[model samples]
Target: MPNAAERPRRIRVQRDGPLIVEGPVEVVGEDGEVTVSHRFTVAVCTCRRSQIYPWCDTSHRRRRDRRSGPPGGEAG
Candidate 1:
């Protein structure tokens, strides 16, 4: 492996879930708003239902019909 300074950041994508990114990161929304995260690891939300936008609040864990909504379904 490379030394600490050369270590690569890692990102994980689940088969049916969010993108897990190594953190101390920031996300920019379409409206130009920024969301910052300082955690060692961050679960970036793919579904727009997170109350804590840009961060996964496990909202993708909810179940619903795929044909009617986003990933993990409509949550109802």
Candidate 2:
């Protein structure tokens, strides 16, 4: 835990992306579960597409537009 005199941690909110937070960070879920990361920095998933919940695996970058068919522009 940080002391009262310690500076507040910084969290950067990326548009349509994960939240970049300075670590080590402790995340508490709605289920009263806790997720901890000791990395110097962590990307917290906001899109909820990551297989690893609460941790960003760049899944948001893989999002495909339904109207655009597929990556190769193949309509199936």
CA-lDDT, candidates in order? 0.73, 0.81
Candidate 2 residue-wise lDDT, 3-68, digit = tens: 342688889988767999989988888898989998989999998899998999888767857776
Candidate 2, TM-score vs. the true structure?
Answer: 0.77
Q: Residue 52 in model 2: shift from native, Å? A: 0.8
Weakest 10 consecutive residues of candidate 2 by summed lDDT: 67-76
Alpha carbon deviation, residue 74, candidate 2 (Å): 23
Clashing pairs in 1: none
Task: Give per-model TM-scores.
Answer: 0.70, 0.77
Question: How well does candidate 2 score on lDDT at residue 45?
Answer: 95
Candidate 2 stretches greater than 4 Å from native: 1-5, 64-76
Model 1 lDDT tens row, 13-74:
87546789887677889998878887889988888778887888877667445675675343
Show where candidate 1 strays beyond 4 Å: 1-5, 66-76
Q: For model 1, where is the 10-residue window of minimal lDDT? A: 67-76
